[model samples]
Target: MGVTEYSAKKLYAHLGFANGRDTMVAEGYRMDVLHVWGTHELSTADLLEWLGEFSPQSVEWIDDSSCTLRCNIIMINESTVLHVLHKLAEPFDRRVALTAMAAVISTMNTHNNGGDFERALRPPKLSPVEGTSDRLMPPCGRWFKSISSPERALCLYLRIAHKG
Candidate 1:
């Protein structure tokens, strides 16, 4: 198995989830595992760079040196396996602007809605690590996966997981 596949297996194993190919079954709900893995070390600059490469619009740093990140909205299932850990116990209020959640009206437009990137955002809940719990469910009822890369410097896990 490739790194991504291995990571997926590890993740499912961590969650005690059963899987077939790209799909994972948890709590009677089937979810597609959109897993990605790499050896990139965790670093604020590198994290921003990767975010810039993937989702750039809502990237904000609470402290660039500290590598704190804030996103407006995300609909992709991001995950990696590594060491350093940082998680948000709670999410921002819907009344709060600047970073609204993205909605999944259709698969194609999951990343954007009506040209607005931030709407109906549901961020990920904190997980001690993989396999320690069932799939982390954000407010939107979608699966959210957050994993660190092999480097332990950066993690691929993002916000908002979508089911195709």
Candidate 2:
């Protein structure tokens, strides 16, 4: 996607969307479309640099060439979302572009809910207690057999949820 120099300067000044830094308070945008078509060489370092510039919360690598960068839109607000969408518009088809708009609506809804959105997305953190994570036990057998009936059922549900 192409960003005009003027637009790039605006993003850089207001939102910290820079080419060389990881110290960003907000990642400028989220690309809803997963696939990048046409023959092009996108190096790993270049991809990582792009990710750093935008500063998404985390980047999930689909493969060497493809990755899903997730940003909690609630953190960036609507104007930045629109700016990113404007930048993304050139690379995507109409259908794919529409999905990005739809995501904006969903993200706004989550934003309206205050802390709930952030809490739901935060990964489970290990407590100060050492080896505490192991207490939950893995999804496999022998350990599964050791838990009480209710805990076992809860563990199974968690295992399925994790799989999804």
Candidate 3:
């Protein structure tokens, strides 16, 4: 719908994942999907497919330009997408940055947890994207996290997803 959403969606599609929402990260979730927590591994091609399809906008690609994305822990059905992805592939490890594999209880402090205008902490104490808590978060559980705010650059893609 928007430039950022288009970029995210483009990234997902490029990763070979079925279109999420005709946009970026907010795309719809397909029923045929399957995942395993740190066990089921996907090829780098598949992972790349999923990330490349997301629309790219407002981002400049450079040989060394990179951003560390922090996401909350997430669990869907029987697997942890982020964890497994990172565990299964060496490229994934470079793709994601968790800093730690364990969740810290202090992230829920609210006072310092993201504060009023800061980016959300990884393994978020409370992940509004997944509508769940990160009490026992792991490094590989970042896949299911996404902000739902349309105004936020990171969450803008989710806003265009199908309202399940």
TM-score of each: 0.23, 0.25, 0.18
Q: Per-residue lDDT for 15-101 in model 3, tens only?
A: 445454333334544221222122113332332333332311112111121111111111231122332232222222212444332
* Cα displacement (Å) at residue 137, model 2: 43
Query: Alpha carbon lDDT of residue 138, candidate 1?
Result: 22
Candidate 3 accuracy as TM-score? 0.18
In angstroms, the error of model 2 at 94 is 8.7
lDDT of 1: 0.32
User: Considering only N, C-alpha and C atoms within 3 Å, which residue pairs clash in candidate 2?
Assistant: none
User: Is candidate 1 or 2 superior in lDDT?
Assistant: 2
- Candidate 2 Cα outliers beyond 4 Å, as residue runs: 1-44, 51-53, 71-82, 94-164
Best by TM-score: 2
Across 1-164, the per-residue lDDT of candidate 2 in tens digits comes to 45565764444343224551123322423333222111024443433354344343433444332333331211123233334434432221234445787797578757677467656656798555774444343323111111221211221110000101
Ranked candidates (TM-score, high to low): 2, 1, 3
Clashes of each: 12, 0, 33
Q: Each candidate: RMSD to true structure?
A: 17.9, 19.4, 17.7
For model 3, the run of ten residues with the poorest summed lDDT: 65-74
